[model samples]
Target: MTDADAQTAPDADVTQLEELSVTANRVDGPQAAVGSAISSISGEELEQRQIRVVSDVLRELPGVAVNRTGPAGAATAVRIRGSEANQTLVIVDGIRVNDPGTSGEFDFANLLNLEVERVDVLRGPQSALYGSDAIGGVINIVTRKGEPGPPRFRASIEGGSFKTMTGTASVSGGTEAYDFLFAGQGFSTRGVSTASRFDAVVPTRSLDHDGYKSGTGLAKVSVRPTEALEFTGVARYTEFDADRDGFGATSDGYPFAAAVDNRDTEKGKQFFGRAQAKATLLGGAWDHILGLSYTNQDRRSFAGTDLKTYASLGEMTRFDYQTNVRFETQGALPASHVLTFGADHTRDAVKSFTAFPFPADAPNPLRKHIDNAALVGQYQIGFFEKLFVTGSVRRDFNDRFEEATTYRFASAYTFDQTKTKIRGSWGTGVKNPTTFELFGFSGNYVPNSDLKPERGEGWDVGVDQPIWDDRIVIDATYFQQRVRDLISSETVPDPGDPTGFVNRPINLAGTSKIDGVELGLTLKPINGLTLRSAYTFTDGQDATGATLVRRPTHIASFNANYAFLDDRANVNLGVIYNGRQRDLAYDAATFARTSVPLKAYTLISLAASYKLHQNAEIYGRVENLFDKNYEEVLTYNTPGRTAYGGLKVSF
Candidate 1:
């Protein structure tokens, strides 16, 4: 797979090619060459949406759901195939960005969309390529690299409701020896007020006005002194401030409103840098890449009042450094045999501080550092030009706990000169406990250092085919995952007060399972118009046979885009529907009452963009076109009938 393949795949099944290219380990080609259910969103699509955050970009993907718990740069989580937020691995430029301090999960709200080039979503169980935290698969964000051409520059500014303002600028230039690119963006908005839903004890409304301000920048430079020696480096930095209000109470008990106002100001910064060098060894037969990267993130929230009981002034910091060296040999045994071997080393450290009440007068902090080293190898073999098999294994050693090993096996077969393909893979994954889950400000909770990593095993099988002169492509896949030794906080009775309680993180008694099916279609009725659709059906249950909360069983999305006016203008219409999900658990003690029901809802959006010149364009979008009010999260409502417009220019 090469740049040529990405730019000129067969038009008959372009959609399938997009999916295949993304799902198959960054490989660029058509569906017949890839083995999993994957989805890719282009940069053009992002601009058409006029989306400011990653959450907005992901809304177009089926089976993927995002909950904006608060304002921009606040707390946000994404669910894939009914998996918990922590079960997914978010990779930026091939480096894991999940903060170890915050349950090894990065808040999606803090992500800006300006620097993204494309996004690839692997549907399920991707531990084979990545490692832990990939139990539910991967969402890989690939940033832009400087194009090989003359110097180019662009800038734009836009304004909208709530007194929002945004500005972006970028410059790129590359020659044979070196290439450099830089981009930056700033965003600000006067956010909505906070309110508690179905709550009586707390005020229904609060005067707190929540808002956010954020800035992000990216830089990349590649140096190629010789044909056999190349060095590439990239860096990204983002910082933001967010305001949050208070909590609420309901008859059922204490209910935290999904959205709230805050006197507290949350501030955080993320920095990442990487350098990789590829060299030819063993007389050109052996190609190797040595890469090193370091990432750091810090977040702190300062409250205006003494929130010792209900809230806490919190601070968290995390650092991770990784080095990977892999050597590959093509035609090892035959023209179609390839083998790769690598060693991975990672160091992770986290520190968390929280202010508490009473006996704990001052802020308490917990700190931990872990070192892990692994040996990994993978092999691919093609048979008779139509069949392929791949296998991989890895053994990991950790200084803080036990050692674990995992493996994966997959096979692929193609027909019709590779116009149709079928493939399957099975693998394992693990997740380490976060600092907060282990140790935090003391209250009705206890720390458990003995908690083991949550383990998962799963497999995916899928088929990709072309129909009707290859103008229509269809892909269907099914996946299943079983996770054991799941860690969760459970409420136990308080000895002092019968009705009171304590919450503690404990390993569950048995395994939880997630099974689902995904169907995708791409039809080109005529030139200049394309219709793409996808549907996902998921069934998630624990050993106790209980439905997973915050997960919907059915999710679907579709889009139609037409390029007309001599290819100078475009129109896009999209629909997204989410099925009912099991609601919040009102009473954790009983665990007997059924879950509340979240209603099903659908949303429609329209976008139109006109090119004013070769390098400039104007775009607008009407979201929630019908003003249909819905909730990505229970109680916390999403915006209604919002309209946004923007401008773009490129040199």
Candidate 2:
């Protein structure tokens, strides 16, 4: 289902509360019927809040944490329920976008909300449906498609602090025979300094402003020649350039202190394309779908005085083909049953190049490739018409590792009299080692070809209830996960030298455990007014009983939106609170690891919009309304009290 099918709240209107979600089970169905922890944000809500980056939108989500190296366009990491950044799978238009060459991690800083219609975050293990790298969760981003109406056009422009500016344009329309949509966006900003001095004792560094620029484009088309057959195609591309700080440069160490000016820049390009066909047979009881997808990514980092003397390049390409079949019987056992099965094959390859010193000969580029195949099956059964149970299994074969099998079971029960539901799910997940982890760089890392895949088992139980004439909805979930063979780097004595040490990746002998509780409340006290609040409490520990790094113990957010003046104007307010956390920093002088405590911080934002005509509107927003000084990462600068205004025209 599309984002326009339902309101902001999951249970805003009890009669029309069945919002279809495909991320939970890889099939379209009511979100409430799925026995898992899930949440979504619509494009309309994102526009109202004036949010442009995907990372900003995810900070308020339950069971999620965001850490950035600096301000806008900087490297950003997203952690779900205390899991590692690479453990969560990121999917865009049904294709995995994680970078295979970089520890299988997806950087959220580059994911702009240009033509996105909806974002669904599914918490906990989902390997039975999505395969590897789903040990933590899945983030599915659905792009906008044509609407079934007259052709529409839209344009928007905005400017904010730090010399930031953005512009976007889109066109979408649909007919009985064909539908299409196209969108483009451009963004640029002169951001704050990525690194801070901390104290006067530190060596002097260039106080230059980091700059970022990006362009994004999306196109989608669908055609239906017959009533039972359809075809769809999608393409997306993004190009970005960012000025960044030197690596390993902190108060303790300044590698470029002698240089008068640092010229460090990072450039990247990403592209994805997919084509699919669907057909119905056996009098509509059987449905079949075939899909093919391709992805390509290239990144380059430049450093030194000339900005080209020293450089590194990383590239990745992947191709996948999948087929799925769904069968429904007229008369099933007990009540009714829907059976689904699918198989997919994927090939991925990576190449890297690096030049150590100025004008030095580039090392021989490293290239690697791997193949994967998987088969999956799922069955959903309904008993007494109110209780639903789903069971799924998957088997995966990897060229570099051992074969693995995963399974999941989930159930949901609804009480018609009280409009309450109870749901629970248990699942197993796996994450294979990435190319970077298995093969070391030129001289920095040590390769370990025998590294094992990380494995996890997790479960969650939750309740959803509606009260006050269905105007208020509340949900609470408790979840726990245990992971084995956790991957980490250790300093080991070099094989060639007696006194030298090298960092090597290895699997930890002990297991890591993470558990959390999530609570959500939605209120629609009156017409044109809505409020939402969510709270999360997470506790994570390794085998050594030390808290995990960068995982907050508590997080909470509250948002309110109201419209008045004959629906011509609206106001939005949001407040977010992040609890204290811990991280480890390396002391260059002493060559020791030190635990650092980060202070807690809160942020408040306000937005308002007014309609000037039927097809035009103006909007303004203030971020960090309180001008609070906070740091999500140590020695990184955060923007304070930024204001922006924009105009949108639609036809």
Candidate 3:
């Protein structure tokens, strides 16, 4: 899940245990066949770890860094392999959910675990299949699809420290011809003060605690009237309202920019939908798929009574088509060849208004739109049923300023003697500047309409070894990446308004380098007991050789799960360690930004669940066991130790 999750040895053949991945390739295939780094977390792991938000478990993942500005519902950003947060792509089912209005990044703060069947994380440059914003990697969330069975229902509710409460309900059913599922979830919490007491700008050490509330709904349907034809579709919607802290106070007070405490809140609504049709032809030798996806998001921020201090709306419409051809022969030493190709077009539009300190002078009045189309092709060959190789290329056409080409090559070879797999991948990627950076947010933030897109290239090599009859697994990988034309913010004097200065995005003169090592181990030492651990070392720097902000150099995690009492009771424990990091701090008195050191810290959590009956269960967990005082972002206070308990029932 987080890394290499532990699982008991299966009754089936150990060497045959294979996990499927869809994000690495356009189509579903065995993870071991991808020749790239990938990991998966099942729904069972979500319930076992008592995880409500996806970010809570991402810290244990290799090559990933999670940063939350303050409390549970605060602004959360995830970076993969030392890349920028916006470089990663977030996908829900077949739809892309990255908001086009907010720097082209998906905020993990409002994501809830509702009807999630599996989460797959792909670590590599993937522009060959996915067009843009995938320079770093991809996070794919797969939802539950109904199977042929009787109707089923499930419900759960929990309450815990900090006046937190959560509830979820779901109903699913299906028949031979059609299947459907519907689910909903809700969460609310009274969080801790977002501003740190150590900050000089804080009005007082004891300020009102920030709070958050959210709700989400999901629906899915599928139809299969004939063996050669099928149709499927899904829709999801989410809404959230969260309290936030203000930037540091300005000279005249009322910080337009935050370590100062204030009653500021943010609200957002997002909706995504996708529909697809698949057909099989030529006696299963040819497969075709056509799909359409839509995304809409509206976000607003309120400063005290001013409900529309800042607001934005983003929308995207996409059409995709793909085909696959296969040629294979049945034999003792079989060899096969497959060819895959696809084309996609997307239209992205955004509009925003900012009414901060200068209501009239601000409130940017421009609406922007961008169009992009891409063609991708891939070829795969497998010989002796043990070695697989894949190569892909893509060309993009954009109405914006940037049009580029990307390439990727990968291979995986397995040895029958030791059941060990050696894998490697190399890829090139490109990311266009977001609308926000291109057009600007407010007058105080100047636009960079002439800015160029960021370009990158990377490579990785790894090995996966299973020993002790699949009871133990060890995985290790090494990766290196280089990025050119990096974008960063710089303060510049406003030629129009001589006395004031504004921040603008600029392309750095040189390249940035990032390299990392990932190691994971999982063991099922005994029946019903499992242990897992992972470690990551990353070295990231700008052209000037300064450590990248918030990129920790060392990280390690350990988790153990035990089932006893004839499998009626289960418990899990997790320990996470984050090495020192560098973060920018704004001096309250001088208002100058300076890079500051953040001490290393560790976090521990424990969860236990017991079955009360065949259809009922009770569970509880303790988070931040030591009440560790630390900060993921400078001046943002993190929550202390907290506890919660809940009951779940299913039929």
Mark the 10 consecutive residues where model 1 has the least summed lDDT. Answer: 1-10
lDDT of 3 at 650: 94
Q: After superposition, how far is residue 398 of candidate 1 from its true place, in Å?
A: 1.2
Deviation (Å) of 479 in candidate 2: 0.5
Quantify all predictions' global Cα lDDT against the true fold.
0.68, 0.76, 0.80
Model 2 over residues 1-651: C-alpha lDDT tens digits? 111111111321112234533345565444444777787777777877778888787887789999988878988999888889999988787667778767787888888888787777888998998788888898877778898889999999999899999999999999988899999999999987776652224445457787899999999998999888878888899999998766443454453221122447888888877777777677656666777777777777777334442223334333333333444345455565667777777776777666642113323466777788888888877665578788989998899888999998888888889979898999999998887677535444566778999999999999888899879989899999899998977766666667655566889888999999998888999999989888999999876677888899999998898989998999999999999999766544322356678899999999999999999999999999999998887667778899998999999
| Candidate 3 ranges with C-alpha deviation above 4 Å | 1-17, 197-205, 250-257, 329-334, 356-363, 587-592
TM agreement with the true structure for every prediction:
0.88, 0.92, 0.93
TM for candidate 1 is 0.88
Give the per-residue lDDT digits (tens) of candidate 3, residues 179-268. 999999999999888875422444554577899999999999889889888888889999998888777553334322345577888899
Q: Which stretches of model 1 miss by more than 4 angstroms?
A: 1-15, 18-33, 197-208, 250-262, 281-285, 305-335, 357-363, 441-446, 493-500, 586-594
Which one wins by TM-score: 2 or 3? 3
- The model with the greatest lDDT is 3
On a 0 to 1 TM-score scale, where does candidate 3 land against the true structure?
0.93
Whichever of 1 and 2 has more lDDT, that candidate is: 2
Residues 73-96 of candidate 1 have per-residue lDDT tens digits of: 557888776677888878776557
